[model samples]
Target: MAKAIQKITLDRSEDIPFDKLELSQKNVRNIKAGVSIEDLANDIALRGLLMSLNVRPVLGDNDEETGRYEVPAGGRRYRALELLIKQKRMAKTEPIPCIVKRGASTSVEDDSLAENVHRLQLHPLDQFRAFQTLHLQGLGEEEMAARYFVSVSTVRQRLRLASVSPRLLDLYANDEMKLEQVMAFSITNDHVRQEQVWDTVSRSHVREPYYIRRLLTEAAVRAADRRAVYVGVEAYEAAGGVVMRDLFEQDQGGWLQDPALLEQLVFEKLKTDAEALKAEEGWKWVDAAIDFPYGHASGLRRFYGERTELSADELARYDEVKAQYDKLDADYAKAEDYSEETETRLEELGNELDRLNDRPHVFDLEEVARGGVFVSLDASGELKIERGFVRPEDEPAGEVDDADDGDNDGNVGVATSVTGGISVNGKPVAVETQEEEDDKIRPLSDRVIEDLTAARTIALRNALASDPIMAFVAALHAFVLKTFFLYGSDSCLEVTMQSAKFGQTQGLGDTVGAKEIEQRHEAWGHDLPKTPAELWDYLVALDEASRQALFAHCVSLSLNAVVQPWNRRPAAIAHAEQLARSIGFDMVDAGWTPTVDNYLGRVTKAHILQAVREAKGEQSAQLIDHLKKPDMAREAARLLEGSGWLPEPLRLAVDETPAVQSNDDAAELVGDNVVEGADADLPAFLAEDADSEDAASEGAEVEEHRHLDPAE
Candidate 1:
């Protein structure tokens, strides 16, 4: 070895004329990847030739020098240079730096393959740091992106990564942490906090990126939150509120740093809006808040207003739409299956008619004089105004008299509205009551009355169960009590309806299902009697159709089709199916589309692909199958939208939820369903989609919902 290594002759490098170099077919990279030709050209123009091209002399038919060189590697650079010359940006005879291979034993193809195969891609951290270093050298993100042949957002993301705590960056570089974890940490710039989260996650087994982000931003409020949406990001920023963003992932509009500031902004804006609305709408007073308890107007007497009649033009539009709808329905009446075009036109016509008929209610000036409005933000961040609620003091003395109403039930807490006597054997049987003989009348003791009413209650229950109509009314009375008067109670029917809250689910309150349910609940709540004592008389006055409609609405609230693992209710699941089947309930029609946050994002990679494949096609799924889980999920959501594709939990099975063949299971199912309430259960968002659709349908966390009904 001391004799020295054998001397070797290196390939000679020289500046070859641009016209003298041509690309060789031996280049291994045929398909385009990474940076594009145009981007590469632009990068090359900005930073001259950073790497020299490899070339071999072209031999003519005579086996002599043809004065041209064939480029085995760096063909892209050759094309880029050739392009610049054609654009007159460079001379045709411009010298291109290249290594000229002569007398080399290696073939040109071998050289090209070796060059590509042996090249190691720059580490992601290195690239991120390089971008950061350029920014430190006085280059803005935009300018650096232009020079690097990447997007400005990409540059910012890389810089964000570099801005992460150096210690975490080292851990990432050493492969102790993942790219996603680093991306999550980059959501904020606080190194101390970043290191602290890292330390917390590093010691725990739950180091998922989602968990990491949660730990970091646990205290921050989401910008998509109702308050933030009401105030708006720009307004918040204008008020000096900071929003933390994750450029690498969907952050649901990022997280707002200042909850107090957001609340202040929301209140101020709401106050302004309420004052304006009160002045314009001519209400006695307007109360503004971000939210109110479900039945904030429980004790207040609400008045219903007649809708303003449609004008000639509006009437004509409604007639036209109605005619079209009728014609379409007639045309499709006999068809076994409706064509898509027909279905679409029918939907459009129906929507048009609904819009035309949805005339705004015009309250009487007298009613408006005494009634106040409750103005608050709805699930969708829009202002919801509840009008025509009158306080008890505001009502004229004796305007609403107890005796004027037809019911003669002595006790205000009576559950039945049987007029005078209890129904016995399809006949009214009056019960003698002891009345005061003196001018100062005395009443029966609580124990005596309770005993008498208990027997009366038993008779009423038996009779009402036989009479479907009254059974329906009885349920509605219980629902009204629970819905409107939470603090007090008078109804004998012990029914409860609690609307399961989605305080923890992101953007759930803003869902279409949520908004529709809340609006429906509020409408019924406002229309109901103020106190349970008046409920029996008030419900008895409604027409048959109106009462049935009210009963249906009340019964709909206690629907809990959610499948939870801890509380397995196979019979209930099947019952929900039977219910869905009865109503032609389609989750797709309910406006629940597959979304990354709601569905695809929660599932495994294979499920995402399967969903895409089913909704779109194999080719479509294949295109995104190679992407990472997040990207694949996002792509699948887009592809599934408007396709009417439903996940297993949402899809109504063709047969049923399976065996309800057991009689005990059947009786149990009926008993469970009989307890329906006045608050809507969280619909299958495919909620949590936590369980397998094949294993169980619409698996949701176990939450209780209650309801009541009436008799003939």
Candidate 2:
């Protein structure tokens, strides 16, 4: 027969008066934790006590029960009740529920410890669903937050988590997915899309929270994007555009889902703004776009507008500030050190007077009639209107030759020329010129001009299509036009090349590639002529090497291999691979390392281990494998330094043949083998911890094996 099972006896519970329940010193909880006493009291006062207090009868000196109980386990709940009585919300005689411990073998401290330790906090998924349940039961977010004593945002965050794809929720519930990953999935409400992203990241070695967010919002425009800021999120939503938000993390103003609509709205708004600006400022022509290429202002005649005269009040203020500023400046320069307050005051006074002096700019009437405007969004997303740019064709007449005048003597009349600039002190100085009636050249009739140009245009097209050399040159001309002109419609051929803009990609501007491009762009900008009209002649005059270099730069800027969700390009990416292979490109050689910030921190702990195992060895990986994900990543980064361990995305295909993987070798990703030369592989912090006995033991173990240094 099986051993007879012992019957269990639970402590009896009773409704004891609040006044009779006394606090016990044997309670183990002395430190404060979650949910403040005041908030808990308020909660209890609102909802009444949910859990009963665990108490035992207070014994006198005679070992007889006193007419009172002492709480041991539910001290916090007891305090909550006491607080309600103190606040006069609950009466002293109010009966409180209590679980009576009668003649228990366990000590009061043991009971208290068991109550807190043996209990399980509610699972995150359960808590999320609880909020959802309360919401479905007609409770508002504020109402639920009030009931739980949490903030409204906290309740909403939980609700958002609960509202995630039910499949993902189930995974979270089953502990198959992390809460952070679940939060990332909550950015979008499209269940199908959410599940799809989950499926995609689930297979990848790195599924960090941020990476998940990036993958989900790849096609969407960031709310901080110039276009999104120009077209406010409210207007985008009003126009039926979806904005995906992350309640758990800062989304950098969130993401606008409807990119097509956003683009359309941005374009329409920019065009409207340009039209309004042109009407207000009397500009001849206005070209509006989301962005002009890098060297758009090249080859244009830029004229600064005149500042309006200051008002009397502004003038007085400027004078007052300037007097104070001048005195302060003299004192500051004479003093050995300046106070922060003094420095700040000087800056303030200077800025104030500067603002007063820098009045609104107004273009001249003649400039307004002859010049044009380029309208677009600036880096900060405000409407940027660049005015008073005179195109080559719109420039005023140059010096008139006396040979053109039939009645003039053979005398060269030295008149000022507006078309050409004179170098004075190495700077181009502008001299205003007046037009002469004799110098004006009359145009032919429109029909006659069209007839002459039509023949030339048709013949040119035929000539370009036949000669590959000229065709290349013509294509190069269009690329230059597109790359350097705000309105690049100069080309007769329909060929277009639009460089990908990466304004929203954080830190991209600071990248090695970006810096090199900027340097090259600035060099070319300094060398190029004043206007796009002269760009063709300049290109034609360049040597073959110079032309090829410029050509390569223009073509390189147009190359975009970014993988976007809405803009999938398998063939293009493959073509990029072919190009890379031809050039023998390597991201490692390009100066990319698996630092904690860029690679290791963005991947899962397993991926970090896998990388270390591959680059170093199983033994080297195991040294840091037992650490937390963040710590592991940092150490792995150090271990893999100069090891050239590239992620799959950065890896180039050396051949068409697929390399085989090993199952048995993969199983040794985190083994306990001694790392040979592991002293060199371990980080300084880990190895130099002389005070840590654990570190000493690890260091000794590392010394046993000498040839498994991860960095090597």
Top TM-score prediction, candidate number: 1
RMSD of each: 16.7, 22.7
Structural RMSD, model 2? 22.7
TM for candidate 1 is 0.58
Model 1, 149: alpha-carbon shift in Å?
Answer: 2.8
| lDDT over C-alpha atoms for residue 27 of model 1 | 96
lDDT of 2 by residue, 1-712 (tens): 8999999988877999988988999999999999988999988878788899999999999989998999988888888888888888889999988899888998999999999999999998889888899899999988888878889999989999888999998888888998888988899999999988888767665578876787788789999988899989999999999899988777788999989999888867865676677777777777666655333443456665666888888888788888999999999899997599998898898888877866776667887787777666766798766676665556677722333333222111111112122101111222322222121222222222222222222222222222344445546655775576433223334444454433222333334554466566645765676457998999999998777677656555545554343332333344444445544456676666677755566555766777898999999987876665655776787789999887655566445322565886545532322122223322222223223236766576456422223322
In angstroms, the error of model 1 at 189 is 2.6
**Any idea how many clashes model 2 has?**
7
TM-score of every model versus the real structure: 0.58, 0.56
